[model samples]
Target: MASNRPAPQGVYVPNDDDFGGYDDDSSWEEWNPTEESIRPVRGRHRVHKRGGGGLARSSTVLGVGVIAAVGAGGMATAQGGKPPVAIEMPDVSAVTDSLPEAKSLPGVGALISDGSDDSAAAGQNVAVAAAPLSAAGVSTTDAEQGTTDAGEALRARIMEQAENQQDQADDAVQKAAEEAAVKEAAAQAAAKQTAAEKKIAAEKAAAKKKAEAERLAKLAKSYTLPVASYTLTGTFGQPGSMWSSGYHTGLDFAAPTGTPIKAVHSGTIKEAGWAGAYGYRTVLELDDGTEVWFCHQSSMNVSAGQKVTTGETIGRVGATGNVTGAHLHMEVHPGGDATGVDPAAWLRGKGQSL
Candidate 1:
């Protein structure tokens, strides 16, 4: 089958010097006879008998043809003493077209050129045919397989790159999620701390308020009303023609004629048995330099500068000291001033309701 393929064309030139033999019939010789005459000479070449068996004289041209065929494809090969492996034939024209011009082939191109336009066709047919054999190392089978491997390699690289990118994306998302969770945990801790601080502050404020209330209750116990079992007949600042002042300056407590009047709080009795419009008045001065005036009393029991305890009976209630009815008119002077404040409001400051 390899022989059925055409030999590579124009690869070598014919020359008389290539074949060493006589061409004319005059150089022919007659036959041999004895075995000693046919024995091979020791120091000389073993000359083989040549006849019409093959083109033995054209062996040089035929060797060039085999080399060309090897270059052009379809050269069978033997491996490991096995039968010769059949080689696939490629298009000789395709292989030749890829090679350099016959003029470029080593040693063959110059011999093919005879310096005449008539030999141009032979020059064109000869070529640098060895390019396919040496550069490619094999026929189209290896080349086709190489192309397929290159494609698969490129695809594998693309897939690897895609997988790497996906891994990167997943890592980024996980990092973001972890950071968000940390932030959320920090925010929750801050909120709980704030709530605890607020609760502590509220508790402190409530405790302070309860302690103040207890102090005020104890202080209220230290005070007492000047007279009990009495009715409030007139309030402070009552406008009427009942006294010297145009407006009433004290509170009036209406009681029976012989009702006992008491000291409002622990204080020194400043003055008693007052004259003029105050008929039987008693003045009590407290520790804070505030004076309490109990007016319109029937009689007095304490004198000036006498220390008296709170709620002590000082005098009896009667119609005295510019009084319209039997009542006790009480007035208060803070820091011992002549102008008095409302006695009802002053008692209320001691936690007493009028």
Candidate 2:
């Protein structure tokens, strides 16, 4: 027995195994239309019928019209017949009115190449014109490295020079300080020496003044003697057997040998020598025409006619006479006269006690 039924609308039908479904609804799963359900296309997709059956025939005609219109719109967009490319406006700031002409860019010939072997030669020429970018033909990377090395060397030189200059300045300062110190020391030493010399001169002056004052004082109180003490031991004409000048011409003194005899006055020694029986006698003459005789000395100290200062030693006392004991005989002569004043009285008149 065979059962027959009407197929469902939009149902799939088999074509072959490769084209498994005739309706292909699986390929259009999102949206699908059947000839029974689809409406005729129109407007942007519209078409007019020449001659057709009914709605099916009209739907196919409308679909053809819609497809033709969409194809025409797409073709126009792809054609070069569209609006010209819009020109870009120029920026005023980028204008070159203020700048000089720029040099040609290197490798620019390559960009304008006509695909010939000569293009390489033109590019090389542009590169030669751009050689000023580097100091030598070497690349910038190598040049920059050399420049860095040179900069470091220059920095080292500058530092060395600075150090040398600093050393010189320090040496000059030290020398100046040393010279100043030496000068100051010399000045101080000179000042001290001058002060010491002044002090010594002042001391010498004071000593000289003191000596002069003492000399003047001695002169004011000075006196003269009439007879030396060594010459007279006894009075005028005393009785004694030790008479040297015949019965003691003057007087005798018994003194030790070598006792000093002094001048009686500031006079001259008139005679000084040995006398008969009055050995080693000395005579001193005065400005008043008076003469004093001393006898019996051990030695005479002054020469005859020599100037004798007052109280100066003329001889030594002794007993060198025609006598028994050592003694001196003294005599005074007024103008060499045999008759003379008493030696004792003459000593008193001259402010001396015999």
Candidate 3:
């Protein structure tokens, strides 16, 4: 007999337990959702039975409660200050269509395609990831090349500067050397000019001295000594008692009584007569108006108006009136005056020693 019963709202209904018991020998198998027989319909809910029986309705209720508890835990986790992220699942059908067919190997079971092409693709990806990027979004190789070029340019600039400096230094040194050479040349020229002037002056001085010597030689040829073969007896300006004056007024030449006297230079006879204290005295007047008096002469050979050349005999030496030995007294007067100069010095002016 069947009895009518009212079930509670949330309670589970159980069927009769026909199997021996839920034992440890039970076997479990994985469910294949891809199989056409087990495929679930869209927008419909259904429960499939396990082999030999269905799970107890209490067990199903307990599984639903567990799923509900897990859903509540996930909601709590979402509310605990973490934001929820949406993930998209890939289409398996599209992935399978793109892959190559599976192949069987000798030792291995069915295997997917060999990964040589995939590895090459992966290598390209790795290369892209490993490369460094610059701030301008360029590759590291290009950046390094740019750095090398810049370095080379900088080095070239430095070398150019050094070469320019060297050239400048060389120019300065060359300029200094040229300046020094110019100064040296100028100095040498000046020295040569000075030497030339000195040579010219020396030549002029020598010529003038030679001309004067020739003129003096010609003049000396026209002059002669007053008397020859005579001994010096008295000198002028000697303090003695033999003269009216306090000093000797003339030179005295001692010789033989008849020694000949000569004219000292070219002159005209002015006085040829005797005077007091001077026997046979003769006077000669030169061209320049100077007079020569020969005193104490033995005789006179020239008259008052006769001209006599140098060395011509004019008188003879004798102590006629004066109280001296055989000697001749000579006196010289400028312009035929009483005042006289030393005859020895006058004769020496005409290049005569005495």
Angstrom error at residue 88, model 3: 42
lDDT of 1 by residue, 200-253 (tens): 999988998788677667767888888888899989998988667888998989
- Winner by TM-score: 1
Provide the lDDT at 220 for model 3. Answer: 67
What lDDT does the true structure give each of the candidates?
0.76, 0.65, 0.74
Give the per-residue lDDT of model 2 (tens digit) for 1-354.
222223344534444343222222232123354564344454565445445556777799877765675566532121323322222468777777755434345555433434457866668755665545334444455456564344454555578799999999999999999999999999999999999989988888888877755654454234344233444557776665655443445655666777677777778888988887777789888888789998888888889889987788788877776656777667788897876567766665565544
**TM-score, cand. 3 vs. native:** 0.43
Q: Extract clashing residue pairs from model 1.
A: 102-126, 102-127, 279-321
Give candidate 1 misplaced runs (Cα > 4 Å): 1-198, 236-248, 275-279, 351-353
Cα RMSD of all models vs. native, in order, equals 24.4, 26.4, 25.3
Listed in order, each prediction's TM-score against the native is 0.46, 0.34, 0.43
lDDT of 3 by residue, 230-332 (tens): 7888898999777788788988888898899999889899899878888889999999999999999888898989999988999898888764688989899
| Root mean square deviation (Cα) for candidate 3 | 25.3
The lDDT-based order of candidates, best leading, equals: 1, 3, 2
Q: Per the 3 Å backbone cut-off, how many clashing residue pairs does candidate 1 have? A: 3
